[model samples]
Target chain A: MSYSILVVDDSPVIRKMMKRSLSLSKLELGTVYEACNGQEALVVLRREWIDVVLADIHMPVMGGTELIEAMSKDPELSKIPVVVVSAERNAQAIAHLKTLGICAHLTKPFTPEQVLHAVDDVLEQVAQRSVA
Target chain B: MSQVLLAGPLGEVTKSVLSEAAFLFCDELSEGAAPLEARLVEATITFEGATPGRITLRLPWHVACEAAANLLGAEPGDDDVEANAHAAVGELLNMISGSALERWFGSGSQWSLGLPSVSEREGRLPSSAPRGELVALAIDDARIELEASLGSVT
Candidate 1:
């Protein structure tokens, strides 16, 4: 089945790159949504049927931390997996992301294989969770 | 830590990030051979936590176009690449700063990377950032400079 995805980041170039990487890869994809910040992402998450989210941690208005926190608090949104794609390298920052319940973290300048691998891993987890 | 300590990691980080993330190739520039074009743009980002500091990146206008085009798989002069040049440079600054911070400090060091701000200006480094240590590189056949100014380490 194709998976609908949401990509949240302030940089237009990054957003475009992420989309290109996904579309060119072997993953089965559906509609891809874009948001400028965590706040905008929240709006999209609430309205759309998203399978996963690839987000950046720092942005104007709201950030990935805030978005993840909001999702964890909500029952429905919490079920969808998140893969953080960011420039964050601090261990503490990454640990904080783990505690917030993200499935994976890929540092920026990531290769398409890395992105596809992370997405595939998360999607597999979702499938297994459904089977159980 | 001081800029002297950061100098090594800065050089390596810029090269790897440009090559891996931006799809741009770069090499450390030889002294006294720096040639910057008439147009340039700077992207600056600030980080806080164990070490608070600012990292600034300067690129020739044409180099920015090359970076954007590479990132987007478009031609350098393509309209989309031209428009995305600023954002591409800003994102590159973010990646370099994030990697450099971890390599300079410990990986477990607590810190928050800031968003990069980009602006177009004419020629060379700006009047600000006198205390910032600079790293020069030859990228896309143009001079690219990076500077880092660190605050008191906590």
Candidate 2:
């Protein structure tokens, strides 16, 4: 089975990096979608069957915090796991994200292995849920 | 006592942040580009509140090309790629600075980052000055520098 992933970040570099990293990893995933920010991501979410969401916290329009809050409220969208990727090192900011029920927090300047591990952990959980 | 004193911790943090960003944005290990060059692109972001200092990134042409290509997931084919990479470099620097400041000054401190200014070559360093201190790091032989004109001792 293939899983669809949505990558949202204001920086095209980060978006491209995420895409390339995932592709190079050769993860058994389906077509990857991209968005500039959380607002754009929401629009994509409505139309696509996204299994996972990788987002950055500090974005121009509708940041990761707002996106997570919005997703948590929506019954259909909330089910999709949301991972927060950021360079912001404020412990409080991270705590706030955790409070919002973000699946995982990956700090900026992350290694490919770190990113892959996060994806694997989330996907594995999703797989187990289906099996159960 | 002196502005250079702050460079010790600040420089370490800045380098860490940049290194992390480099790893994330560039496929350094896989890509043939071994030494990722990052120049300080002429851009500054101000920090307000209790602890305040400006963060700047200066990038030269070649460094900009490699950085842009890495961020865009495509080789620097034309001017468009270079432009996009320049923008990406600014944002990456902003994020790194913001995160580093937050680390030094708890979360409650409200700070604002100014619009990043891009230049083809290095511009004048901040005027106030920080005891003539300049910090540079070697990333696969590419030299990355971080200089600050820290006003008051923190």
Candidate 3:
């Protein structure tokens, strides 16, 4: 079945590139949504029925950390998985992200295949969680 | 460390990112090669922490367009590529800065990377700028410059 997804980042170029890369994924993809930052992403998550979220940290207004934190606080939002795509390389920062409940992390300069793999991996975990 | 010493890591990170992210390969320009004399797009990013510094990238407009197109897997003439050439350069700098910082300090260290800013620049590209140039590259039909100016790190 096809799945809807949301992409959150402050850079339009990155947002555009991620959208293009998502299309390259062999998954049965549905409508892909976009947001400029966490504040905007929250609004979309509240209104849309997105199956997964691919987000970037280090954004203005709000960042991926706060977005994930907000989602974790909400019972319904927390169920949907999040995959972080970012340029962050700090060990502590990445570890901090793990504590926030992100399903997967993909560093910058990733290939479209890499993005697909991340999406697939997270989706698989969600499927397993539902099965058990 | 001085700019001359730090440029090595900066160049290494730049080549790696450009090759992977933009599907472009590059090499360090030799000492004798003619300097890059052309209109260019300059992108800069800052790292704040114990050692605050800035990284800048400068490349020709065509190269920027090509990079944007390649990153999106689109043609250079596409509307999206034309509109985002500056932004493409900026993001490229951002990626380069993140890795460069990691290499300079330990990956486990703490540092905050700022958003990249892009602008237009024109001049002859030397091996190093007054602030500091990590390296110069020959990519396709253009020359690209990577620079970093940082605080004292002994």
Candidate 4:
């Protein structure tokens, strides 16, 4: 199934990288949206049908953690799986993000294979949740 | 002391990150060989928590183009290469700062990263930084400099 995804980062270059990585890996993708920060990501989520979110933690206006927190509080947005694509190295912070119910964490400098695998993993969880 | 501890991981992290993200191969430059020119762009990301400091990355114009091209999956000569280089440098520094902080300060530490900034004007290291190191890396036959210093600079 094709998935509609949102990539959120302050850097346009990194956002473009995510698109290239997904296309190069041949992952099934529907309409892919881009946002510069979490606040913009929220607007996209409201307007589009997104299945997954890829985000960076350091950003202007809003950050990944704050975005996740906002998503968690919203019923519809909460259902959409978030896969963090970040440069976060703090162990506690990563663990904290996990507590918020992120599907996966892919560190920066990640490969296309990693992205495919992470997204696939999130999809599997969605499938299982539906089955349950 | 801090310099000896940090220089290795900073170089190793830079090599790994650039290799994967930008498809750039990096080698450490010998000290005192030649200074990196000021024409390069510099990106800085600061972190605050248990340890407060900043990581500054300098990218040669050509290497920035290569990184932007690789990230965007475009040819190095593409017209958009120059436009994307600034963001590419910032993102690279963001990754380096996060990875380096985790290794240096431990994983459980709480650190908040600042929004990355890119510019031609370089930042001076803080005087409060008791010890720090500057790492020079060669990528695509061009030199990029990285300076990791402790304490915050205003």
Candidate 5:
């Protein structure tokens, strides 16, 4: 099965890399979208059927935490799983993001296998949710 | 801070980050490495928390291009390579700074990172810049430099 994905980060390089990384991990991807920051992400979310969102925490206009919070407030958008792929290392901030309903946290310098595993887990959960 | 104290962690972290993020095998250069020259990309990230400081990363253009190419699964000569390299350096600096902070301050400590900015470096850092020990690495026949300083400089 193929899944539509949204990659949100201020860096154009990271956004491009996530798309390539997904393909490298052999994940079945549909339409892949890109957003520069949380504000742009919200605009994409309003228009597209994004299955999952991969985001970075720090951005210029809006950060990932604010993006996730905005998603959670919307009934439709909240169902899409968010995977934070960041260089963030603070335990407290990470814990807080989890409480905000982030599905997975992939640290920077992650291997392909790590990305594959995290995405797989979130996809499985998303699939199970759809069945229920 | 002491060079020994800072360089050790910075080198280890830089090697690990480049390996994992860009799939490049890198070695920390202890000596005999040439100084940075033309076609270089440098990024600086500021930290705020228990201890506030700044971390700067410098990479030869070739290394930067390879990183961007590898991450994009594209050829070195691709059209976007240069633009992508600029962005990749910023992200790479972000990772390096985060790793260094976690190592020195422990994972539980709270710290926020500012957005990374790119700077032009012809050969060396400015003299006015507080010289925290520099960590140099050899990656794919190119060099990468990382410097850390305690407290804010500006």
Candidate 6:
């Protein structure tokens, strides 16, 4: 089965890389959506049926932290899982994201396999929850 | 205002991140001319914390092209395609700098980055620019140099 995903990041290159990496996964690439920042991701979320959101921590306009906060407060958006992929591995940053209930965190310079594994793990958890 | 030293973990963070990114993206990296002729793709962000500063990525034309090509999933042809190439380089710089800043400052620090500026040719450095450390890394077949200089404001 295929699921839709929303990728939010300010960098076009990273976005492209994420898309490519996702394409390499068992998941279908056509269902993936792209957003340059949190604000844009929110707009896309309202319009699309996204099962998960993959975000970067720092972005112009609206960042990952703000995005998570906004999503967490909304009854409708809160159900969708958010997985953060960033180069920031600071303890405080990790703790803050955890407070927001982020599903998983992937550090930057990660191999394509790492990205695939994270996506798979998140999807598996979501499936188990739905079954429960 | 107290003097903000560009020392400690921040400096080390900058060096390691730049080196890793360069190695991952560039074909080869090497040391070039002094006063370092660089092509800069800079993005500025304002932080609410005690320590705040701008992050910039300076890459040579070759390294920039290689990065762009890698991101685009294409092989770079010639210098004429640099405009398109730098677009990719600019985005790469933005991503690298954004992640680096989040590490130095807390993720919740709430910083906003500006659009990156890509400089193809080296420009004159300001006389008042602080002299900081520089490191180079080689990727694939290109060389990339990163320098962390202190600006007027911290």
- Evaluated at residue A83, the lDDT of candidate 3 is 93
Write down the C-alpha DockQ for each prediction.
0.90, 0.28, 0.79, 0.83, 0.80, 0.28
TM-scores for every predicted model: 0.95, 0.77, 0.94, 0.90, 0.91, 0.75
The reply for model 1, stretches above 4 Å from the true place, is B34-37, B125-129, B152-154
Say which docking band candidate 2 falls in: acceptable
Candidate 6, after superposition: displacement of residue B116 in Å? 5.5
Q: Please give the range of 10 consecutive residues that has the lowest summed lDDT in model 2 chain B.
A: B24-33
Count of steric clashes across candidates, in order: 0, 8, 1, 1, 0, 14
Alpha carbon lDDT of residue A102, candidate 3?
Answer: 90
Model 5 over residues B84-140: C-alpha lDDT tens digits?
A: 887888888888888988998899988898999986556652223646767767775
| Model 1 Cα lDDT, one tens digit per residue, A1-132 | 899999999999999988988987677899999999999999999999999999999999999999999999999899889999999987888899999999999999888788888988998899998899
Residue lDDT tens for model 1, B68-132: 99898898778899899999999999999889988888787788888899999887543344567
Between candidates 3 and 6, the one scoring higher on DockQ is 3
- What's the lDDT for candidate 3? 0.86
| Candidate whose lDDT is highest | 1
Q: Which residue pairs clash in candidate 4?
A: A91-B107
What is candidate 6's CAPRI-style docking category based on DockQ? acceptable
lDDT of 2 by residue, B1-154 (tens): 3555655666666666655555422211233424333334555555555455666655555665666766555666865676676677776676667665665555665544343445555433222353435654545544454555544333
Clashes in model 5: which pairs?
Answer: none
Model 4, residue B50: C-alpha shift (Å): 1.5
lDDT score, candidate 4, position B147: 83
TM-score of chain A of each: 0.97, 0.96, 0.95, 0.93, 0.94, 0.95
The docking quality of candidate 2, as DockQ, is 0.28
lDDT of 2 at B62: 61
